[model samples]
Target: MIDSHNHTSFSEDCKIPLNEMIESAISKGIKHYTITDHLDLDYQDKRFTFSLDHQARREAIFKAQAFYKPKINIYYGLECGVQPHIIKEAEAVIQKEQFDFVIASMHTTHKKDLYTQAFYHGLKPLEAYKAYINEFAWCCEVMNEFSVVGHLDIVKRYDLSLNEVNLEDVKDEICQLLKIIIEKGKGIEINTSGFNDIFQHAFPHPTILKWYKELGGSIITLGSDAHFPEKIAQHYEEALNQIESCGFENITVFKHMKPFEIPISDVRASLKLDIL
Candidate 1:
């Protein structure tokens, strides 16, 4: 199976060593996946840059690929935390690093860390959710570099009870965002992180996936969004089932910054046979 988004020691919030993550993927029978560490440039927190030493990170990936070759295919990728003010800095990193995949995501809105409770302090639940969706749309409209937009509805991760919010309330903005992604040949990932949380849904939600497919957006990727060895490819079979239910017959994978496809039937069969 293909798990296109993941993390390791390269990301500040995660501490698993590079080789350990690779071993974990092998254990899960995930032959194809990306080591997409975080690169949240110009982050509000001064202490946590989420940036990596490009040369060192690349060397580690190369060594792992050589050691694990034929057994596993490790693709080097990056998860860029994008914001309005830091677009240029994000672009510079993309230009410098030749990643197999680039996942643009918004971890904060209005320079406020979404993970912190402070981000939702003043606004009502729906208002807070709307603000995040708006900020994500703005980034999608402006930023031109990236293979896919990661976790398009990540705000739901923090707000476990966002029942007050409705997709129709932000339908225009959401549709525009999806259009831009498809127009630019970019895709979206179905992050399985939420399955481990109380929310029990993919990051973008299955309804959102249906909307994207209805709008003719064909490129969809699957990721466990795993931050640790144990979490690697977590709940992936269910996530793929969710995607298939959304009318996607195939999932996109990346290599050398180019796109490829794998039939969902094969992936699903792998899950049923416990061969992946």
Candidate 2:
């Protein structure tokens, strides 16, 4: 199985070192994965700003790749948390460094951290959902430098009840966003982080995956969004099952910013035999 997203100490919120995180993935039989540390420039919560030591992170990734060569394929990647205000700043960083993959994400709205209660203070659940989804749609429409959009419906992450946020209410905007993603040849990730959370489902949900497929979109990647060793490749079996049911026979894996397909059947069989 290929885990397309993860973080280490390079990210402001995570504490694990890159080598330790890689060792953990290797232990889990994940031979192909990417280290996508966070980089949200000019974020609202000064403490949550996702900046990185570019050269240092690059050196660490290269060292890991050399040590694990032939045994594991470790790709260097970045999870860029974007807002309209910092588009150029994000672009400059992307241009300056070379990344194997770039996962575009929206971690805040109006510079306020979405994970905090302050983001939802005045708005009802549905209101917040609409606003968040619209902001995400805008980002998707405007951003073209990313390989895939991370957690398209991540607003659900903060919702108290999954039922409180209905996709039908925001279907038009979501569809528009999906269309733009497809037109731009970008994809979405099945962020498995939601499985253990109160949301209790993958980000973008299965229905949205079906919608993307129905819209003639096919590129989809899987990510554990792991910040620690234990979280590496979390809930991948369930995610694979859901993607298969959504009519996807293959999943995208990236190398040097280019994506290729691997059959889900192969991944499933490998998992059943404890070989992957």
Best by TM-score: 2
Q: Model 1 over residues 48-143: C-alpha lDDT tens digits?
A: 788888899999999999999999899999999999999988888887887899999988888888776457778887788778777887887788
Question: In candidate 2, what are the lDDT values of residues 1-276, reduced to their tens digit?
Answer: 678899999998999988899888888877688999999888877666578999999998999899998878999899999898888788888877868899999889866788874577778777777777678778877877789999888876775753576778777878888999999999999999989876657887898899999999999998999998999888878888889889999989888889999898877776666642
Q: Model 2 has how many clashing residue pairs?
A: 0
In model 2, pairs of residues that clash are none
Candidate 1 residue 53 C-alpha distance from true site, Å: 1.4
C-alpha lDDT (0 to 100) for residue 143 of candidate 2: 78
All candidates' lDDT scores? 0.84, 0.85
Give per-model CA RMSD: 1.6, 1.5
User: Which residue pairs in candidate 1 have backbone atoms (N, alpha carbon, C) closer than 3 angstroms, thus clashing?
Assistant: none
Error of 1 at 37 (Å): 0.3
Q: Model 2, which residues run further than 4 Å from truth?
A: none
